[model samples]
Target: MIVGPAQQLAYVAADVARLAAAFVRESVGAAAAASTKSTPTDVVTHTDFESERLIRHELMVRCPGSTIVGEEFDDLAGKNSVGWIVDPIDGTVNFLYDLPVVSVSIAATINGQVVAGAVADILRGEVFDATLGGGARRDGEAISASSVSELGQSLVGTGFSYESTVRARQADRLVHLLPQCRDIRCMGSAALNLCWVGCGRLDAYFEKDLKPYDYAAGALIAAEARAMVDLPERNGEQFTIAAAPAIYDQLRGLVA
Candidate 1:
């Protein structure tokens, strides 16, 4: 019995997330070397490469004909229309500092639409996953966004950019947004932050200058969990906003 793309990709995402989680578990607290990416604040580790390699290999072998695009490596195109977007380590700085707030994210897109995704929080051993029209789950149990209707009562999650100037601007935005919301939390991992929104750990989440590998899986999971999601416009400045339905507009307005 052959499964559909959504089902097949969901399974693949789960497996890949599990594998990456295991790698993180074994590698954490070990003496892993790190290197800078675009800036001094943007760092990568050996675990990131190893985890991406593992995911790319498994995805190619299991799916057979799907392109794999990862944060650490060049794109691997395949024959099928499906494409896998992976973030081997979503919070590398935190991981490097042993902060236990990192995650592995995977998403499958069919002809430009995300069909399925999974995000594994390595330290918590929790996995959040979703398929298009299939809702969302954390560790196999169904989940949804919070019911916080007012922005002043909502606990929002956000992230910063690697560029120094961007970080400065993000701080400025946070200053204006801080008093409007109940409080703001900046978890190092964007993927986990989005999953947190899905599981009701956060009432809302928004960030700017995110890459496809950063929010691909997480945004899908949040939307499936009944959160309102606004992805960044294509070929323009990248920004994302996901929040509970009741507070989406208020949050977007304040942040804007």
Candidate 2:
């Protein structure tokens, strides 16, 4: 039973909001129990695992037979084109430190393409969402990228990869970009940074080695808000640069 794009996005966003509340309940002011995933700094916490389980259970109950991929779940399972990709908690470090910047991100990808997505900023009680051919939104109001036309005047966002090698490459890229942008920020939450770009709160965003669940939903929300999307290398690795259409080319060129 295929669902219309609008209803699918709405349903996903509603579920994201519900799961976000659960995450906050388990995370806020609580002692974090974390372990390394890829390295010492790349961590995952108890809340992350619990949130993903709750979300997956609810999603499967609602859309039986649909494939689901999550940061904390088994990646081997159903292979339906209409798949759900999720990052139960995008900024585990921030959550551990009691920072108010993490989010729960979920996306529906149809045959390798993201068709609908949602990101719930649990700390802020805000949801950013979009669907293919449907304009982006926060809560219920429309949103869009900034109109900044010059890279030198644009505020930018970025994140480091869990892989040390990729993080080194990104650090190198930043050396070339830092002198060109008005300012650069590494907010620790890729999903939230992309949402900020979508809502014109940030001028642009760039990052590499991000998983599908990390950036897919926020990237779609950015594009739906009229941001330009670009990939520097098509080597099966996920590298992205998204910005308001005006300065997008300039930023993309720099990252490329």
Candidate 3:
């Protein structure tokens, strides 16, 4: 496996994300589910596979022998030494519905630990990136999480499951939390939601049933921006939270 500095890996991801995002942005108008996964609503658009292919090829060419786990076709992944976790299109539903809230996310890991990552907003043209022990940035500008101390004044972000039963249960969980916080926004993309938190557009964000590719890049960006984060155990179906420092405890109390 080839090993490089986390900062170097971060740049590789950011560049590839920009490339893939441009390709995906060009295909959004014709978006439709070519298939489904896990559930009928868990869609897989044609562009999803194409985007992942572009990303996988570029990453492999750039980092020879590196492992890759992508959302579109991860069943064929290689070993996880100097690995990458990628979500070629993080908001597939939004893309399929012709909404502009979509992203391309990639995270580089060294021996199972995330060390660098990047998330690019397709239509927004903003890229958020970070490396372990390095601060976060959005389009080359430094970014930070919200400083809001009161949970009632914090603007939170969340998402729902594709499963109707799980969505209903998640909705019920929000009922108790809704009144306790400023209010939640469901942007349909966990990666973008966590980036929004990193840039202070959202004070906190949490969601259940997330896979590694869904939150890997965004979580690193948020954490580098000084947000507190708690992710699910590897391959476990649990919740992930990225919250402002001052409101971390309070926000987790309500959502966790």
Leading candidate by TM-score: 1
Clashing pairs in model 3, backbone N/Cα/C closer than 3 A: none
**Ranking of all candidate structures by their TM-score, best first:** 1, 3, 2
Ranking by lDDT: 3, 1, 2
> What are the lDDT scores of the predictions, listed in order?
0.90, 0.82, 0.91
For residues 32-81, write the lDDT of model 2, one tens digit per residue: 75688878888888888888888887777776667888998796366455
Worst-scoring 10-residue span by lDDT in model 1: 230-239
Superposition error at 41 for model 3 (Å): 1.0
Comparing 1 and 3 on TM-score, the stronger one = 1
lDDT of 2: 0.82
Question: RMSD to the native, candidate 2?
Answer: 2.5
Instruction: Please give, for residues 1-256, the per-residue lDDT of candidate 1 as tens digits.
Output: 8777797799889988998899878988873557888987688899999999999989988889888889999998889789999999999888888898999999999997899999999999989999999999998899999998899999999998889898898898898999999999998899999989998999999898999999999999999999998888642547788899999998888774
Q: Kindly give the number of clashing pairs for every candidate.
A: 0, 0, 0
TM-score of 2: 0.91
Candidate 3, poorest ten consecutive residues by summed lDDT: 73-82
